[model samples]
Target: MTELEQDEYTSACEHALTNSMNEIKQRYLKLNTIFLVTLNAATSGKKLMALLLRRLQKIDSEFLSGLSGLVMF
Candidate 1:
């Protein structure tokens, strides 16, 4: 791929990496509120969201590092 394509790929990857984090936060908070109001069990969903958050954090860090390196060139 050309430099331009690489740059675009890096940017897109960066977005994907962070997108999940945001969704995780939104879902977690929403679920928290729902549980507070309705008191339904959310153990499984919370566990899955936590796992997703951790994985996404790793991906986001890697993507940011790569994107920064590409920006340096």
Candidate 2:
């Protein structure tokens, strides 16, 4: 392939790799928050977690910051 074509291909690959890594990072953060919630639930026991979860539902900040990282593109 010509130099121009090779450069274009390299740029495209770089863009794709960057986008893929960003997506993976976002997903990893989401899963980690999920795991934390699950662990909190398990340790505190489901019933208390259920009650607390309901209470926490109204308070967005507790979990919303973590969620924002996953949502903000």
Candidate 3:
């Protein structure tokens, strides 16, 4: 692809990643409230959300790094 297409791809990728992170953050906050209210009942869900958040973070980092490499060309 041309430089313009690459730039557009990078922007779109970053925007999508940001949206994903924001959604996850909102869900995590909601889960936190539920965990506080229900204690034991929400423990598993909270843990799963935490795990998912961490994995998404890792993926985000890897994705940004890969995109940066691409931009260097």
lDDT tens digits, residues 1-73, model 1? 9999999999998897686566556655654554453333334577655665665566556656655654554
Backbone clashes counted, model 3 = 0
User: Which lDDT tens digits does candidate 3 get at residues 10-70?
Assistant: 9999997777666656656655654455554345687766766665566556656655555
lDDT of each prediction vs. the true structure? 0.61, 0.66, 0.64
Best by TM-score: 2
Better of 2 and 3 by TM-score: 2
Model 2 regions lying over 4 Å from their true place: 47-73
Rank by TM-score, descending? 2, 3, 1
Q: Extract clashing residue pairs from model 1.
A: none
Give a tens-digit lDDT track for model 2, residues 1-73.
9999999999997896687667666666665665568568878788977766665553445446645654563
Ranking by lDDT: 2, 3, 1
Candidate 2: lDDT over CA atoms? 0.66
